[model samples]
Target: MVKSVPAWLRILSVVFVALTALILLAPLIVVVGVSVSESQFIAFPPNGLSLRWYSQVLSSNAYLGAGWISIQIALMVTGFATLIGGAAAIAIHRRQLPFSDVLATVFLSPLVLPTIIYAIGMLMFWSSAFGPVSPVTLALSHTIIALPYVVRTTLAVLAESNPYLEEAARTMGANRLQRLWFVVVPQCIPGLAAGAFFAFNISFDEAVLSLFLRGPTLTTLPVQIYGQLEFSPDPSVAAVSTIMIALTIVLIFVIDRMLGLTKFASA
Candidate 1:
């Protein structure tokens, strides 16, 4: 039998959860409030209510271009990262290749390494090999950084699955391709979906790599926000940020519906 918590301890736990939630959500609330403010400057309490800042954001050519670029890069990153990372995870889990442990570590090294270091190295390497930074460069860099998350999530789910399924399929006359397609791929779906969401979110919000690879021609949404904050920031910036936050929330909801958030947590 399990012992129940004391009332005082339960009350303290509730208070702690409430405090944590408030701390995490306060900035988001302020951003949404400022986005709707009529004030020329960003303010927490907001000075009156208006949607003109959002209208200005929608009307700005620079913002529109940056948003489109961000969307494209994020989609590309999600596709490449999910494919490459998921495949690598399966290979590593099967231990089919030499130095599987080392390969896994190498694949995940980007997660432990400082992103700024990778950004600088990427910038120099690209400048020497290619000529200037472009959308392709941004997409490739984002894929590299996002790959680790996909690999990790996929590995986690694979670890918890029945290890004998692949062998059982083989004994039942299923070829390699058939086993992978019908058995392994189905097991990896939840992890892949979670990782794809993570990849999309990271690419959409990435700044360091985008900043280092930035050119006169290339600008992503986060880079645009940074430029605005550096030069002239106003309520319009808050409006754009609010919209991005909303997009993130929607993605979270979709991920939850697709696989259930608890699946990820348990994985």
Candidate 2:
């Protein structure tokens, strides 16, 4: 039988957990507080709570336009990242492709490489080939960075799956495509959903690549926020950030509902 924890050890565990949660959530709490401040400028203690900044963000055309652009790009990145990353994970897991190890490394290389280096290279290449940056450029660049998250998540689920399931399906007269569709795909659903959430979150919050690829006409929410902070930031910026935080929280809830977040805890 497992031994019960000592009282002191249990107390220590609770304290540690509380501290960890505080560290993780402090910035979000501060941002939410600042967003509600009545002060024209951002204030931490929030000089009298009010929704005026949120109202300002809603009325601002620039924020609305940037938000729309960000949403569109994030949706596109989610699709492309899920498809490409899921496929690459399957190939790597099965060891079907030549140099599966190398292929996995190649797919995950973006996570290791510096974003600024990739951004500079993409800018130069796009400048020479396409002439100017566009939404497509930004979407594709976000996909490149977000792909590794999908691949890693999918691979985690795939690794935990029954290895003999495919062979058993073949024994029951299932063809390659049928086995892949009915068997492999079902096993990957949880991972795919998790990865899609990650892709959307990454794409939406991504600032560095968006900044590097931004043209005169191209402005995402994060890029717009960066510009505001550089010039003159007010509570409106905090409000926008709070909204983004809310979006991320909603996505997290959705992922948990769809895939049981606890299922991936060990992963």
Candidate 3:
């Protein structure tokens, strides 16, 4: 039988949890605080609560253009990452390939590699091979980085699934496509959904690759925010950050309600 925790240990755990939450949430609190401040410049412990900065962000053409570009690239990255990573994970899990382990390692290598290193290397390579960086380049680069998350999450779900499901389907005379579509794909839905959200979030918030690949007309929202911070600081930056945080939270909430991310996470 599991023993109950002592009072002292429980109190200590509560305190530790509170401290960890504070540490993790402090920056977001400051950003939200600054976002609503009436002050022209960014300041936490806001002078007065206002939504003028948000209005400014909405009205600004530069912000809108950057936001649109970010959305487009993020969507493209999510689609590519989900499709390719999900298929790769399934193949790796089946061990049908000659070098399944090596293939898995190759697919996941980007996760361990330094983003700055990859960004620089990719930028140089693209410049030489393709001449000019485009939104397509950014989408592909983001897909490469985001692919590992999809592969990892999908693999986790598949690992927990019944190994005999495919064989059972085959015994029932289910064709290859029928087995995959009716059995395997259904099992992978939760993991694929979670990974898709992760991919979208990463691509939308990605700054390193965007910074390296940005052209005159191809700035993403993160790159624009960086430029603003470097040249001129304002509460508008905080407003943009708060909006991004809100959108991400909403997206996660929606997905969790639909697919129950707890299943993917538990796996």
Candidate 4:
């Protein structure tokens, strides 16, 4: 039988959990605090509270344009990553194809590689092959990075699901396409939802690829914020960061609602 925790040990455990929560939440709290600061500069434990920075961000053309661009690219990445990764995960789960392990690794290899390395490669490859970088290049690069997340999440969900599902479908006169559409896809829904959110998060926050592949007319929200931070940052940056954080939190809730957090925690 498992031993019961002593009272003092339990107290320490509570303290540890509280500390961990604080550590994880402190940075976001700081960002939100700074975003509401009345001061022009980014100062945590802000002097006073105001929404002036948020208003400034809303009124800024560059920020608005960059946000729109980021949204477009993230949506495209989500679509492409979900379709490709879902199909690839389905294929891998079957293990019908020869060298399935090798193929699985190939599909997930992008996740193992550093984003900076791929960013540089994509920039060089695109510049040399295509005339100049554009939103499409960024979208493709983001999709490449996001695809692995989708594949891994979908595969994780598939791995935990009933292995006999497809066979049962076959026994019920379901062909490959019907079995895939009905049983396999349904089982992977939780993983797909989690992975899609991750894809959108990555594409929205990605700066390395966006920076290197940035064209004269294309700028993502993260890239815009990076430029401002490198040159002249203010509470406006904090406001934008806070907005992104809010979006991420919303997606997290949505994912949790669609599929319990425990289901995709591994993913």
**Per-residue lDDT of model 4, residues 1-267, tens digit only:** 998989999999999999999999999999899999998777879988899998999999999999999999999999999989999998998899999999999998998999999998988898889879888899999999999899998988888899887888899999988998898899998778788899999999998899998977899999999999899999999999999999988988898898777655754
Name the lDDT value of residue 232 in candidate 4.
Answer: 95
TM-score of every candidate relative to the true structure: 0.92, 0.90, 0.92, 0.91
Residue pairs clashing, model 2: none
Cα lDDT, all candidates: 0.94, 0.94, 0.93, 0.91
Candidate 2 ranges beyond 4 A from true positions: 1-21, 262-266
What's the lDDT of the predicted structure labeled candidate 3?
Answer: 0.93
Task: Compute the lDDT for candidate 1.
Answer: 0.94
Error of 2 at 124 (Å): 1.0
Question: Could you list the CA RMSD of all candidates, in the order they appear?
Answer: 2.1, 2.5, 2.2, 2.2
Tell me how far the alpha carbon of residue 245 in candidate 1 is from the true structure, in angstroms, after superposition.
Answer: 0.3
Cα-based lDDT at residue 120, candidate 2: 97
Backbone clashes (count) for model 2: 0
**lDDT of each residue in 1-267, candidate 2, tens digit only:** 998999999999999999999999999999999999998777898999899999999999999999999999999999999999998899999997789999999999999999999999999999999999999999999999999999999999899999999999999999989999999989999889899999999999999999999988799999999999999998999999999999988987898888777876566
Residue-by-residue lDDT tens digits, candidate 3, 1-267: 898998999999999999999999999999999999998777879999899999999999999999999999999999999999999899999998899999999999999999999999999999999899999999999999999999998998899899899999999999999999999999998789888999999999999999999999999999999999899979999999999999988988977797676764565
**Model 4 clashing-pair count:** 0
